[model samples]
Every structure is written in structure tokens, then in C-alpha cells.
Target: MSTSQTEGLLQQLLQEATVVARLSGQAIISFAWLWPIRGVLYTLLHPHVILSVSRTLFTSLLTSAIIFTVLAFFTYLPQAAFLSIFTGPLGPILALLLVGAESVFLVTFFARALFLEPALSQVFDTTLVSRGQNSLVRDGKTKYASSTKKEGIEGALVRPFQALSRDGLMKYLLSLPLNFVPVIGTVAFLFINGQRGGPGWHTRYFQLKGWDSARRKRFIESRKAEYTAFGMATMLFTFIPLVGLVFSFTNTVGAALWAADIEARENLIESPRANAPNSPKTNEGDVRAKAE
Candidate 1:
């Protein structure tokens, strides 16, 4: 890269790092943005939301154990040996933690893809109903209803991929190499991934709002700090093996509760964007025109 390009890259990384440090205060408020704790409480009260966990628990644990052992066998010794160059004595413990985290991440990613989509959508919609945002759920069902194909939340699941973004997955894969940098590298990996993880918790809400990409971008950017904090928190909580799978559901409920609150406050539950006949066709153009 040229001098200008290199300088620009450094500036970008610094800006991203600054984002976490700056907005974490907003996240500390406990009830603002996506209050993850609320999700846990909500799940505890509603046993149905956690039904998805029971289904995936065995598979998630088995896969985690298999991956953990494999990574330990092939990677632990070398990764620890490498870290010893820096920490000397702490290398073995650190390497074990890193391997476990990596296994959890991989299992969480694939396991979510294979089994969690339909169940998660149900969780969000169920929470929405509890929040008295039943109309929004009806709207989603009507919009996606097809006698020949799948109906209701099933249709919604494919578009948002149960809140999993392909671009985000690609970014995550690119970030995995960051683990090689030792301790700072591990922190960077978590921080970088957390940037997207928080916003991901809201994908269902965005879809329900019928938000175009530009509009969703604007909303998330406006509250980037809060989103980053939430994402970082999710990453930390869900970074554990086997147990992280449970946080995944809680976070979904939390996002739904947050979405319901937004709808209630803004009267957005009955908004035209979600109800208008041509919303799907016009939203992108409308968002661009407003931006201009």
C-alpha cells in the first residue's frame, strides 16, 4: 500500500477500537439498547423460549468436545510453545482457553446455522407477542404466508437467516487469524468480532420493521456505541463452550424485547413502513432519496 493507504488503514483501526472504549458507558446503564440480562430473565420465565436449547444441547456439546480435543491435540502444544516466547509460564493455560474459545465459536457458528433458525424466529415472535406487539407478528405472517411453501416466521427466517449475516460470517472468518498475535491479538479478535455481534442481535427487529439496508445502517450507526457494547457483551458471554449456546437464546429474547419497546414508544407497531402495500418495493428508493 501507498503512504496514504497505510495511514488511512491505521486511522480506521484506531477509530474502531475507540468505538468500544467510548460507548461502553452507554452499555453500563443495564436497560438501554439490547439489555442482555433482560433476555435471561425473560427466558427463565418462559420455558418455551429455551426449548431450542434442549434440542441442540447434545449436538453442541459433542461437537464442542470433538473440536476441543482435535484442536488441543494438533494446536495446543505449538500454540502454547509460541505464547511461551512472550508470557513464559502462562502460555499453557492461555493456549487451553484459546482453543476452547475457538471450538465454541466454530460450533456456535455451524450449530446455529443448522438447527437454530426456525426456533429462534419463534422465540423473537413469541416475545413480541408477550410485549403486545401481536400486530407486528401478524404482519410478518401475512407478508410471508404461502400455502404451497412455508408460512409465518419460517419465511422470515430465510431473509435474515435467523439474524445471521453472511457478510458478518465472512468478516468473522477473516478475524480468526487475529488469534495468532498472542494476548493482544486475542483481545483484538474479540473486540473486532463484537463490533458486528451486537447489531446482529437485532436483525429480527430490523426485518420486522421492513427496514431497507440504508435505513438499518442509519439506525445502527446512530447508536453505534450502544450496539458495540452489546455486541462485545454478547461475545464475552457466548464465548464459552457448551454454555454459550444458552446465551444465544437469551440474547435473541433480549433483542425482541428491545424491539417491542421501540415499537411501543414510536407507535411503530402500526407504522406504514411495516403495513403499507408497496413497502417492500419502495423502501430502498425512499431511504436513498432521504439520504440525498
Candidate 2:
């Protein structure tokens, strides 16, 4: 590898390391919510947690495999000569100059799919269930709350491979060599993103979960400083190598959980009146009080 390539590899490796550590940290914090074992065992063996990590890894492999196969065939194409312009230093440099097309595309797309879609579904479902329970489940005594592809392509197989597909790839592509900058800000931004995407993904989820714009905005404002601090730790971890890569995946999930917890706390803080037991009127009164 040339100097640039070597540096790129080191940066990439560090990015992966911190990503994993950040994920692990998030997971630990999530389990902490359950108290004692609820937090401990869930952190270790949660199926969704494991599946999320596996999915991230698999996505990386699939995208890479697709890119490689295409690149191999493209080199033989007659038009391939024109694409060589991207191979030299100028290509990556030019890529760096672009204001992160990859980040904008991947983060928005994946965040929408992973968090928003499901959240909307849940919201609708909860609404319907709540309505239904009012009528059916409780026989008018309780309120029923109830609620209820594409593609195309052509390419040197690899020409398309160069396309951005995921948040990781986007962040990776966006920062480019700028990540090697000696200044604290640039490097810090690059490293933290590896973990930031994860929490960011979750923030979207909370927003979808009935967190109105004002409430969501307030939570983000309150937590922004802490998130930045936590991200610094994540940046350092992602630089560790094999271990770091694993942590990166964990970091994404952990960050999401951490953000959710913060929002949860905020919600509780904003409304201190808890529902009283026994009489339905007490529950109704509590709800009224909460709204007030």
C-alpha cells in the first residue's frame, strides 16, 4: 500500500474499533436500566442486540462483495479507461471535497427504514389498541386503543460499487483523508461518527415514538453536550483494531439505547404524576394531571 493507502487503512481500522466500543458502552448502559441482572444478562444475550450487530457486519460484507465483483469486470471494459481518473490521489481528494453525499444519503435512508418505519407502525398499533380496549376488552369500561420495492442498475459492476450504500461507507467516504488532519475538530468528527450514526439512528426512533417536535427538540438540546463527550470516548475505542470493529457495531446500538434512556428520563421529569392504582377514576385523574 502507498502511504495514503496505509494511512487510510489505519484510519479505517481505528474507526471500526471505536464503533464497537461505543456499541458496547451503549449496551452496558441499556442493561443498567433494568437494574442488576436485567441489565447484565440483557446486555450479554439480547437477541435483537445480537441480530443488529450481525446485520451490520453482513451488510458490510454484501456491499463489499458486490463492489469487488463489479470492479473486477469493469477493468476489462473499454470505457474502463475513463474511470481510472478515480484511482489516483485526485479521486479521493475530490471525494473529500464533496460535502458528504454518502452521509446524507445513507444515514437518511437507513435511519428512515430502521427507526421510522417501525415506530410509525407501533404508533398506529398503539392508537388502535387503546381505542379497542376501551370498547371491546373492557366492555365500554375501558377505552379501546387500537391501531393497525424498487431498483435498477447498470455498471462496470464496480462503477456502481463505488456508489454509497450505508452510513458507515458514507461517513468513511465523507471524511476521507481529512480524517488525518492534525487539528482536534476534524479527526474528532470522523472518529465519533462511527458511533454517532448508531445513536443518531435511535434518536430518530424516539422522535417517531410519539415524541412531538418540541419535546424531541428539547431532549436533543439538553443531551447534546453529553452526547459529544460520550462520542469522544467512542472515537478512541474505534481506533483499536479487531476489537474496535466489534465495538463499533455495539456502539451504534448502545448509543441508540442511551439516547432513548435520556429521553425517557426527560419524559418522566417533565411529568411527575404517576398513575394511582385501584379506581379507574384515579387513572383518569392521573392522565388529566399529566396533561396539565
RMSD of 1: 8.6
Clashing residue pairs, backbone N/CA/C < 3 A, model 1 = 198-231
| Candidate 1 local lDDT, 146-215, one digit each (tens) | 4215423334352222223554454455566556566777777666666666677777777666666899
Candidate 2's C-alpha runs over 4 A off are: 1-43, 52-57, 61-175, 182-186, 191-199, 230-249, 263-272, 275-292
- lDDT (CA) per prediction: 0.64, 0.38
lDDT (C-alpha) at residue 183 in model 2? 41
Which 10 consecutive positions of candidate 1 have the poorest summed lDDT?
155-164
| Tens-digit lDDT string for candidate 2 (1-292) | 3677657756775765565445554544533322222222433664444353455555543443343344335432322233235444433332332223223333334433343233322322232232222111132111112211012212111011112235345445545544333344344454345334323423333423534458756765554434444554444443332233233344444444443344345445745343345423434533432332
TM-score of each: 0.69, 0.38
Question: What is the lDDT for 56 in model 1?
Answer: 63
What TM-score does structure 1 among the candidates reach?
Answer: 0.69
